[model samples]
Target: MKFSVFLDLIISGAFVLAAFLWYLASSDNAKTRREKGDDESITKAEIFKSWIIIILLCILGLGYFFSFIGSLSL
Candidate 1:
């Protein structure tokens, strides 16, 4: 395949990997908090940060995909 297609695939893969890692981390964090009792809990800021990372990765992946498409039309 072409270089752009290959790059898009890589980006897509990276996004998926990042999302999975985030999910695992959040789950682990929640389990740990539960084991620690009611003294600790997840914070809004932490959730917000995770969302921000996911959003940024999604945006980057889409941007690369669009750029690949644009390149094809030129």
Candidate 2:
């Protein structure tokens, strides 16, 4: 049970960090006009990937929380 709680907290922190990173990435200045208009990277897709990862981590944490507590004797 204690282990589950600790894992949950870690996962929560990871989610928070991912959110902050997404916000920071979104808030970056637009590319300069002279830098080339046709080139683009998959930064947004990567951010989305991070979001998915964080969500999965949260789900795993929840599962661990429930399973651990349910199996423990009160």
The number of clashing residue pairs in each candidate reads 0, 0
Give lDDT tens digits, candidate 2, residues 12-56: 566556656655554352234224453355554655675676566
Instruction: List model 1 lDDT by residue over 1-74, tens digit each.
Output: 48766687677668767877886787677667667773443544566677788778777777776766776677
lDDT of each: 0.70, 0.56
Candidate 2 lands at a TM-score of 0.44
Each model's TM-score, in the order given?
0.64, 0.44
Please list the residue runs of candidate 2 whose C-alpha ends up more than 4 Å from where it truly belongs after superposition.
1-41
Candidate that would win on TM-score: 1
List all candidate RMSDs to the true structure: 2.6, 5.3
- After TM-score superposition, the amount by which residue 16's alpha carbon in candidate 1 deviates from its true location, in angstroms, is 3.8
Residue 5 error, candidate 2, Å:
12
